[model samples]
Target chain A: MSSTLIALAAVCAANPFRVAACAPTSTDIRRQAVAVATALSVAAVGLLAVLSEAILDWLNVSGSSSRIAAGAAVLVVGTRDLFIQPPSPEPALQGWRAGIVPMGFPVILTPALAILAISAGSERGAGTAVGMIGAAILVVAVIAVGNIRGTYWRTATVGSAGVVFGTLLLLNGVTAI
Target chain B: MSPVSTRVVRGVLAWILVLGVVALVVHPEGCGQPSSGEVNEAAVATVAWFGANINDDGTFVYRYDRAENRPLGGYNDVRHAGVLLSLYQAESAGIEGAAEIADRGLAYVDERLLNTPIGLVFGRGASARSGSVGLLVAALDERRWATGADDRDPLLLALGRTLTGVVNADGSVGASINTATGSTSGRSPFFTGEVLWALARLHLTFPDENFDEPALRVYRYLIEDRDRVESPWPPVSDHWGAYALETMSRWPNADDLQLEPDLELDGPATRQWLARQLGLFGLQVRYESQRQGGITRLTRGTVALPAGVGTLGEGIGNYLRFLDRFEVTDIDVDALNERTNCVAHLLTNRQVSAAQAQQYAEPLRVQGAWFRNDITQMDDQQHALSALLLLEDWMPQ
Candidate 1:
């Protein structure tokens, strides 16, 4: 959605959205979306490097098979983004409800991201996971403040595009391997 | 000011004024002159006598006379070789009389007893060689004091080196070889104890870099070696044990000394043992009866029992001297008093001829009768002058 893209763009411009991705706050829906996306990126990078083998084992897949699957998923997302036109403009929401689903769930809590969260929870125990989640929420609340300005969205648009291109290269590399 | 505060301030001011007046009236130079000079002179004389009696080969003869010697020999015969070494060294140092005595004694030892253990036992199986090393070390220090001589005797150095070699790494010195056949069977605690004492004395006096290790090893063995079980005469050999313990305890580095657990004895136990051997003197008064009633008097031309009481007196005197030297306050004076009382009782009760009593008791007196009566006279006296050296530091100003 246009609204979602604008929120992501705003996050890229205001570094606060990077932190907010792991935490959520009562903020504009687009701001929350940007924060969630940032959290997903962080979790994905962490899982691939630090806990790749454990993640694969937990998913009941070999390391090589998991890498292949991740590459295919990334390729599918990149292709869809590059070729497809969105059908509807995203609806803007003003409060906490908007942050709960799109921003707090899918953007930050994607399937790969969920795997990482589960692995982190298992590694550090449930108490540490709760503490980490609390910290993430605090960070996202602070980041959401920047969403009030339109200039932030313009700058964030370029950054999000860069991230998508990088993610595409990463997927190609994984597929080649 | 309030009346009370004013009174307190005035009182303090008056006290200070009185102290100032007293200090001005008492001259330190006048008070110190006689005792200090006398002590120094006595020290010099004692060192001189030791030097004069030394033989050429590093041993000392009893006296100039050979015919007057008893079978066990004279007091000098028993102790001179060991005592003279310090005297000779003192004389060499420019202590007026000490140099002559040291030279004479050194010459005598060189000529008569070089390379033989005869010097080790000058009287009554008293070890001359082992005792000589200690005496020599003491003499060297005296000679340094007497003649201002800085050059140490190489023979004395060799003697220490040889002793270090004889002592095992574990601290035991091997038994002396039988003169007839150069074979040793078991160790003699007396000889070993004396040797360790000498080594410790040498460390105290000359204090070379090499002496520390061997001295500590020997000290540990003598004071703490339990399972190496070597002493044959337990009762009679106690003086040596006390001597070693006392000497080791006086060493500057004693705190760093570690002994085997089995060998480590508490201070009380060691003190008790020394008390029994030295008589009930000062703090060690538990065994007063043993020395209390024996042969209280001696007469002219009296061939009486050799009341072994003198040994205890001498031992107590030595212990006191050690305590005084080290400034040790943790001693039982009751023990010392009991021993002193016994000796005093013996002396007072005996109706012996003055000359006979003096002759018999002189050697038994801790630092000779002169110092025994008046410590002020201990300066140049030649008996157990070491005791005086220790006491001088503690003397009331």
Candidate 2:
């Protein structure tokens, strides 16, 4: 039990999902992986709004007004992005530096990840939560390098797939609510 | 390039080689004398010079000429007190002038100085002043043990008693004492640890029941019952934690106290922590490069300057000093070397007026700058002194 606990703690603390994904496989690989991971994580955060109720019921959690409020915030952001006319590409390109800025920071691994951490921790115990986080980090690492040389269609497909998955999660959350 | 210019460049290169050799010769490593011996000699010179100049009452005019003669005067008391404690660690160590240095240092401490809290010790002069007292207490305790003196020097005894007064009924030491109102500041780990380390040493030396009570209380306050609600630990509290843990480890009956393993990270763990902390030192180098890349300074900045760019230099210096005293080896000396070289480069290249650099960077010179700068000197001197004492102790005499 102690060893299990230790392993869990190590996983949680290690956050391997982010770690594996974040490693610089190569410059080209880094850029592609980060783009895919960022789109997915952001979409995941957005889908939380649609699936908030389900998430709460599934986890058997309550009295987290703050969590609901945060979900609303993510919903507003995702909705705005979906509706708003796309801005000039130059500014967007300048904004998202490869692996250093949004991709490294708030996008792939962020406060939402931390929130997921807290939820995972409270529900499944700290060790399991940490392990999940590690898994997520590993996922990020794989995605970071794997998508680098893919064509624009492949990149768009990955982004579209993330949006679809996020929408499904959102629907589940709402049904649960 | 012209022949004359080429010749001049060659001359400069040759001169640089010569200077490098000279520096290496002057500060040789692994020599029979040990590094701490050099530090001790420097510290003693600082103390003796201060004693001669700063009258018994701890008041003196700042004479730049006299200051030039003893450039280390600003840091003399604090650095000397630290070295005195280091010297106390040596087997067959002499405590010849430690008492006098302690007396001179203690004369400055009063209710007014005692009122300032620990965090403010950096901004206010209280930490440096109180820290000197702490060092002296540790030194005097060692002196008493070495000499088998039943009654310690009266001044030293008085100072020890005064330190006790700094502690309140609760384990905390009042930040500073209001001389007029006789009031004290709120309790803090930084002050409490300084007081505790000193009191712990004194208790070990004399086995006083009175000292033990507060010492234990302070120890508990600092370690077991830290402010976990707001920020896992209190700010400016880790230094105290490190000091308390290290000092406790040295106690004859330390095994009685069940300290947490995490708090008492072993040498390797501690060294790793030290390495991570060195990253901040690296950041400071980056910050310096950004700030002064194109700027020119009069004096080629070197290792001897008093300005501390960041907490990393101070942290590295403190940790190294602690490690040396604890006799913990297996440290990543290469990492330390890299960090030290970074700091050396910063100091050497730091843009300062020719006059200021001339005065500040002179060997053994102390600036009237903040105590952080002064602490760098104290930390370096003590680490060196401890290393020397360790070497001397192990020497096959």
Candidate 3:
């Protein structure tokens, strides 16, 4: 697999959905605002994708090593989330800050996500890999708003997909006998 | 689905993931970089594979089908000689029983020799290949070196002369000799190097003979003409060139060794050529390291055939021998050493283990060999064995 896509599946599995769901905005405005924030996340991710080749060259790292590094970072994040119930990450905020805060920052633009973005871009083309993530985030934002139930229950499907996919990508990178 | 059940399903999956990962960790036999001890064990197993498969009639299985549990047809005398060389090398390295097995293989090749104007070449009539004859000389020479015996000197001199019979004045080498006519014809990029290597070894064995001249002349042809004139795309990575230098590097008073002046060969020039050859090998090792069974294949390219990668190991191991004895400038010894070890690591990772071989109908035929899918060839073991033995000491303890 493109280690990046496995990483993408790892970081995106349930993160944006929960982040969008827990957004403090009213449901009416939430989808539009999440869309805006998600587009911004896609841009930032695309930026990393464009720079990934240069970044790797500067660091004297190869594409395979970069993929492993990205897998490792995503794995750690996913594994941590699996054991500890990750809080609905961003705090409650008012105005346009709601979109930019939780959804744009940590929920959408997480460290694991950034690593996956660069890796995907490096492995596949930036246009395709980042576009896939952009498309995924856009879809997750709509689902998050439409499916929100209650803060106590948290629309609550477990996002073990990240953990599962992270494990898959990590093992795939392991040289086999 | 209700939220409660959804949460329960997710919880179940999380626990299952944990259990699955645990299962993998506990039973991951033969994965990742093998320790130096494992590398030693791996080499022993590979040597065992050669000993186990040499047929009663002196030939070997040639190729084998693990899934079908049958010996594949066809054999190359060149590979036979190559394997024999590895056995002798193993014997030299303190591998028990290797010399006995090598002696048996040597006798088999000895029976196939054709008396030619060049001396005695292996194979009969029109089908004889000088490459095989070349490797036979090297194998016989390897045994003599290992045991310090001259009992084979008459045969070695005859076979060594057989290699020179094919060489023209400008260092061009014909790979095959027409036994009926006592003539050598045809050019092979591969035979070119192996023959050159054999000639170099011949020079060392009896420095008084004309063996050193052809050996030096062949080195000149190899470094200058083969690629630009013949132009095999992606150019040939001549492991035999490295092997020849290794043989020469071990010569007494090697530091002051001199080649014919008109041949334009010198220590600095030889060192540079070897360093370049090693560069090609290092690149191949790195590329092989990137190969995976997943989509990474789309990016990294599919895994190479086992023997092809194994040659990289052989090349690096031999070239490293050159570097160690001579001062090759602008090379990173540690990085080069690490890359050499990476080939061993790659070979070790790809080799069929005892556990995995049990899935085959015949496990003995399966273990200690590398297969592309279901089939493994003689050179796969031949090169991997030579590589493991050649590079064994450089790997960390």
lDDT of 3 by residue, A31-68 (tens): 66676677788888889888987865565444444555
> What is every candidate's C-alpha DockQ against the true complex, given to 2 decimals?
0.00, 0.02, 0.04
TM-score of each: 0.41, 0.43, 0.65
> Alpha-carbon error at B137 in model 3, in Å?
0.7
Q: Which one is best on lDDT? A: 3
lDDT of 2 by residue, A1-177 (tens): 122332232223223233333334456655564555445544443354335445544543321222222232223223322433221111112323434333444334433343444434433455554554555455555544453332334333333433343333323222210
Model 3 share of native interface contacts: 0.00
- Model 2 lDDT tens row, B208-284: 54666667666655554444322333133144344455566566765454445433435343444444344444333
TM-score per candidate for chain A alone? 0.38, 0.40, 0.80
* lDDT string, candidate 3, B44-125, tens digits: 8888887788888787668898777888899778888998888888888888888788787776776787776667888854
> Highest DockQ, which number?
3
The Cα error of candidate 3 at residue B4, in Å, is 43
Ranking of candidates on TM-score, top first: 3, 2, 1
Which portions of model 1 miss their true places by more than 4 Å? A1-177, B1-78, B85-99, B112-138, B141-148, B175-186, B205-208, B225-234, B237-247, B260-314, B321-331, B337-397
What stretches of model 3 exceed 4 Å from their correct place? A1-177, B1-33, B256-268
Q: Candidate 2 — which residues are off by over 4 angstroms?
A: A1-177, B1-53, B56-136, B142-170, B178-183, B187-189, B208-210, B224-241, B258-397
lDDT of 2 at B64: 27
1 against 3, candidate with superior DockQ = 3
